[model samples]
Target: MTNVLLDAHLNAKLADFAGSSLDGSPLLVVVTKSHRRPGDTCCVEADISAFASTLYTIVTGQSPYHDLSDYKIDERFVHGSFPQTDSLGPLGKLISRCWRDEYPDSKSVCKEIQGMC
Candidate 1:
Protein backbone atom coordinates (compact mmCIF):
# COMPACT_ATOMS: atom_id res chain seq x y z
CA MET A 1 0.00 0.00 0.00
CA THR A 2 1.79 3.05 -1.21
CA ASN A 3 0.13 6.10 0.27
CA VAL A 4 0.34 8.23 -2.90
CA LEU A 5 -1.24 11.62 -3.10
CA LEU A 6 -1.73 14.07 -6.00
CA ASP A 7 -3.23 17.48 -6.65
CA ALA A 8 -6.57 17.45 -8.51
CA HIS A 9 -5.00 18.61 -11.74
CA LEU A 10 -2.20 16.07 -11.74
CA ASN A 11 -4.62 13.24 -11.30
CA ALA A 12 -6.45 14.25 -14.45
CA LYS A 13 -3.22 14.69 -16.33
CA LEU A 14 -2.11 11.23 -15.34
CA ALA A 15 -5.29 9.76 -16.69
CA ASP A 16 -4.90 11.53 -20.00
CA PHE A 17 -1.25 10.66 -20.05
CA ALA A 18 -1.96 7.07 -19.23
CA GLY A 19 -4.69 6.87 -21.81
CA SER A 20 -2.31 8.40 -24.33
CA SER A 21 0.38 5.95 -23.39
CA LEU A 22 -1.69 2.81 -23.03
CA ASP A 23 -0.74 1.47 -26.46
CA GLY A 24 1.68 -1.40 -26.91
CA SER A 25 5.03 0.32 -26.85
CA PRO A 26 8.29 -0.53 -25.28
CA LEU A 27 9.12 3.15 -24.69
CA LEU A 28 7.77 6.71 -24.87
CA VAL A 29 9.55 10.02 -25.10
CA VAL A 30 9.37 13.14 -22.92
CA VAL A 31 11.24 16.35 -23.47
CA THR A 32 11.11 19.03 -20.78
CA LYS A 33 12.82 22.27 -21.71
CA SER A 34 12.78 23.18 -18.02
CA HIS A 35 14.79 20.11 -17.10
CA ARG A 36 18.30 19.20 -18.08
CA ARG A 37 18.69 16.25 -20.43
CA PRO A 38 21.36 13.84 -19.36
CA GLY A 39 24.05 13.02 -21.89
CA ASP A 40 23.49 9.33 -21.31
CA THR A 41 19.71 9.40 -21.06
CA CYS A 42 16.74 9.13 -23.40
CA CYS A 43 13.16 10.21 -22.73
CA VAL A 44 11.03 7.34 -23.98
CA GLU A 45 7.23 7.62 -23.76
CA ALA A 46 6.86 4.55 -21.58
CA ASP A 47 9.48 5.89 -19.28
CA ILE A 48 7.66 9.18 -19.20
CA SER A 49 4.36 7.39 -18.77
CA ALA A 50 5.74 5.09 -16.12
CA PHE A 51 7.35 7.99 -14.35
CA ALA A 52 4.20 10.08 -14.43
CA SER A 53 1.92 7.18 -13.57
CA THR A 54 4.03 5.99 -10.68
CA LEU A 55 4.55 9.50 -9.48
CA TYR A 56 0.84 10.09 -9.78
CA THR A 57 0.22 6.92 -7.85
CA ILE A 58 2.70 8.01 -5.26
CA VAL A 59 0.72 11.22 -4.98
CA THR A 60 -2.80 9.79 -5.12
CA GLY A 61 -2.30 6.95 -2.65
CA GLN A 62 -3.00 4.15 -5.11
CA SER A 63 0.31 2.35 -5.74
CA PRO A 64 4.00 2.53 -5.02
CA TYR A 65 7.15 2.62 -7.14
CA HIS A 66 7.75 -0.95 -6.16
CA ASP A 67 4.39 -1.97 -7.54
CA LEU A 68 4.46 -0.14 -10.85
CA SER A 69 5.82 -1.72 -14.03
CA ASP A 70 9.53 -2.29 -14.37
CA TYR A 71 11.20 0.59 -12.54
CA LYS A 72 14.71 -0.44 -13.55
CA ILE A 73 14.11 0.70 -17.13
CA ASP A 74 16.19 3.77 -17.88
CA GLU A 75 16.88 6.09 -20.82
CA ARG A 76 20.62 6.11 -20.38
CA PHE A 77 20.92 3.28 -22.86
CA VAL A 78 19.69 5.33 -25.81
CA HIS A 79 21.33 8.60 -24.76
CA GLY A 80 18.74 10.73 -26.52
CA SER A 81 15.07 11.78 -26.57
CA PHE A 82 13.87 8.63 -28.30
CA PRO A 83 14.54 10.27 -31.60
CA GLN A 84 13.45 8.48 -34.78
CA THR A 85 17.13 7.74 -35.12
CA ASP A 86 17.16 6.77 -31.49
CA SER A 87 15.93 3.34 -32.61
CA LEU A 88 13.09 2.71 -30.20
CA GLY A 89 11.53 0.47 -32.91
CA PRO A 90 7.88 0.14 -33.95
CA LEU A 91 6.58 -0.20 -30.44
CA GLY A 92 7.90 3.20 -29.58
CA LYS A 93 6.27 4.64 -32.66
CA LEU A 94 3.00 2.96 -31.79
CA ILE A 95 3.11 4.47 -28.34
CA SER A 96 3.96 7.82 -29.85
CA ARG A 97 0.91 7.63 -32.10
CA CYS A 98 -1.33 6.75 -29.19
CA TRP A 99 0.11 9.61 -27.23
CA ARG A 100 -0.52 12.00 -30.06
CA ASP A 101 -4.06 10.76 -30.49
CA GLU A 102 -4.60 11.35 -26.80
CA TYR A 103 -3.41 14.93 -27.12
CA PRO A 104 -6.53 16.85 -26.22
CA ASP A 105 -7.42 20.30 -27.45
CA SER A 106 -5.59 23.08 -25.66
CA LYS A 107 -8.81 24.23 -24.03
CA SER A 108 -9.31 20.82 -22.41
CA VAL A 109 -5.92 19.15 -22.70
CA CYS A 110 -4.47 20.75 -19.62
CA LYS A 111 -7.42 20.09 -17.39
CA GLU A 112 -7.92 16.57 -18.74
CA ILE A 113 -4.27 15.68 -18.43
CA GLN A 114 -4.09 17.19 -14.97
CA GLY A 115 -6.91 14.98 -13.78
CA MET A 116 -4.82 11.88 -14.50
CA CYS A 117 -1.26 12.91 -13.94
Candidate 2:
Protein backbone atom coordinates (compact mmCIF):
# COMPACT_ATOMS: atom_id res chain seq x y z
CA MET A 1 0.00 0.00 0.00
CA THR A 2 2.83 2.38 0.77
CA ASN A 3 4.41 1.58 -2.55
CA VAL A 4 1.12 2.27 -4.31
CA LEU A 5 0.79 5.59 -2.55
CA LEU A 6 4.36 6.56 -3.42
CA ASP A 7 3.87 5.61 -7.05
CA ALA A 8 0.66 7.61 -7.30
CA HIS A 9 2.30 10.59 -5.66
CA LEU A 10 5.22 10.50 -8.08
CA ASN A 11 2.90 10.16 -11.05
CA ALA A 12 0.79 13.09 -9.93
CA LYS A 13 3.91 15.17 -9.42
CA LEU A 14 5.13 14.31 -12.90
CA ALA A 15 1.80 15.29 -14.40
CA ASP A 16 1.93 18.59 -12.57
CA PHE A 17 5.48 19.20 -13.73
CA ALA A 18 4.32 18.62 -17.29
CA GLY A 19 2.21 21.77 -16.96
CA SER A 20 -1.34 22.37 -18.09
CA SER A 21 -2.10 23.34 -21.63
CA LEU A 22 -4.05 26.45 -22.64
CA ASP A 23 -7.19 24.32 -22.47
CA GLY A 24 -6.15 23.12 -19.03
CA SER A 25 -5.73 19.51 -20.07
CA PRO A 26 -3.79 17.96 -17.25
CA LEU A 27 -4.58 16.13 -14.04
CA LEU A 28 -8.08 17.52 -13.69
CA VAL A 29 -8.84 14.53 -11.47
CA VAL A 30 -6.53 15.90 -8.81
CA VAL A 31 -6.82 19.65 -9.33
CA THR A 32 -7.37 22.01 -6.42
CA LYS A 33 -10.77 23.59 -5.81
CA SER A 34 -9.36 27.09 -6.27
CA HIS A 35 -7.89 26.11 -9.62
CA ARG A 36 -11.38 25.11 -10.72
CA ARG A 37 -12.35 28.75 -10.64
CA PRO A 38 -12.03 30.96 -13.69
CA GLY A 39 -8.69 32.75 -14.20
CA ASP A 40 -7.05 31.06 -11.22
CA THR A 41 -3.46 29.90 -11.75
CA CYS A 42 -1.57 27.08 -10.07
CA CYS A 43 0.19 27.95 -6.81
CA VAL A 44 1.92 26.14 -3.97
CA GLU A 45 -1.44 25.65 -2.31
CA ALA A 46 -2.64 24.01 -5.50
CA ASP A 47 0.27 21.60 -5.36
CA ILE A 48 -0.63 20.65 -1.81
CA SER A 49 -4.24 20.16 -2.77
CA ALA A 50 -3.32 17.97 -5.72
CA PHE A 51 -0.98 15.91 -3.60
CA ALA A 52 -3.66 15.45 -0.99
CA SER A 53 -6.14 14.36 -3.59
CA THR A 54 -3.63 11.95 -5.03
CA LEU A 55 -3.08 10.48 -1.59
CA TYR A 56 -6.79 10.15 -1.13
CA THR A 57 -7.03 8.28 -4.39
CA ILE A 58 -4.25 5.86 -3.49
CA VAL A 59 -5.52 5.22 0.01
CA THR A 60 -9.12 4.77 -0.98
CA GLY A 61 -8.48 3.01 -4.28
CA GLN A 62 -10.72 5.53 -5.99
CA SER A 63 -10.52 9.06 -7.29
CA PRO A 64 -12.04 11.94 -5.41
CA TYR A 65 -15.45 12.82 -6.84
CA HIS A 66 -15.40 9.59 -8.79
CA ASP A 67 -19.15 9.45 -9.01
CA LEU A 68 -19.50 12.87 -10.57
CA SER A 69 -19.17 13.94 -14.15
CA ASP A 70 -16.36 16.33 -15.01
CA TYR A 71 -18.73 19.30 -15.13
CA LYS A 72 -20.34 18.30 -11.86
CA ILE A 73 -16.97 17.75 -10.27
CA ASP A 74 -15.96 21.26 -11.21
CA GLU A 75 -19.17 22.63 -9.81
CA ARG A 76 -18.76 20.70 -6.56
CA PHE A 77 -15.19 21.83 -6.09
CA VAL A 78 -16.08 25.41 -6.91
CA HIS A 79 -18.69 25.21 -4.19
CA GLY A 80 -16.23 23.66 -1.70
CA SER A 81 -18.08 20.38 -1.65
CA PHE A 82 -15.37 17.78 -1.24
CA PRO A 83 -15.97 14.13 -0.43
CA GLN A 84 -15.94 13.25 3.25
CA THR A 85 -12.65 12.26 4.86
CA ASP A 86 -13.85 11.53 8.36
CA SER A 87 -13.18 7.79 8.10
CA LEU A 88 -9.64 8.25 6.83
CA GLY A 89 -8.11 9.06 10.23
CA PRO A 90 -5.04 11.32 10.44
CA LEU A 91 -4.29 11.23 6.75
CA GLY A 92 -7.84 12.33 6.09
CA LYS A 93 -7.36 15.35 8.32
CA LEU A 94 -4.25 16.28 6.38
CA ILE A 95 -6.12 15.90 3.11
CA SER A 96 -8.91 18.09 4.44
CA ARG A 97 -6.42 20.82 5.29
CA CYS A 98 -4.93 20.71 1.83
CA TRP A 99 -8.33 20.77 0.13
CA ARG A 100 -9.28 23.72 2.31
CA ASP A 101 -6.08 25.58 1.46
CA GLU A 102 -5.06 25.68 5.12
CA TYR A 103 -1.38 25.02 4.38
CA PRO A 104 0.68 27.92 3.02
CA ASP A 105 2.79 25.67 0.83
CA SER A 106 3.88 22.14 -0.01
CA LYS A 107 6.77 22.33 2.49
CA SER A 108 4.28 22.82 5.29
CA VAL A 109 2.34 19.78 4.14
CA CYS A 110 5.60 17.85 3.87
CA LYS A 111 6.54 18.78 7.42
CA GLU A 112 3.18 17.60 8.67
CA ILE A 113 3.56 14.33 6.80
CA GLN A 114 7.06 13.84 8.16
CA GLY A 115 5.70 14.37 11.64
CA MET A 116 3.18 11.63 10.91
CA CYS A 117 6.08 9.24 10.50
Best by TM-score: 2
- Please give, for residues 6-113, the per-residue lDDT of candidate 2 as tens digits: 364455324333445456454444434323432344556655666777788878887788777778877876777888999999999999888888999778888999
Report per-prediction Cα RMSD to one decimal: 13.5, 5.8
Tens-place lDDT digits, model 1, residues 35-117: 21233223343344334334333344443223323322234222332223114344334333323334333334345445545
Model 2 bad stretches (over 4 Å): 1-16, 20-39
- Candidate 2's TM-score: 0.70
What C-alpha lDDT values do all the predictions have?
A: 0.34, 0.68
Q: List TM-scores for all candidates, in order.
A: 0.21, 0.70
Candidate 1, residue 21: Cα displacement in angstroms equals 21
- The residue-level lDDT of candidate 1 at 99 comes to 33
Error of 1 at 97 (Å): 12
Output the lDDT of residue 45, model 2: 60
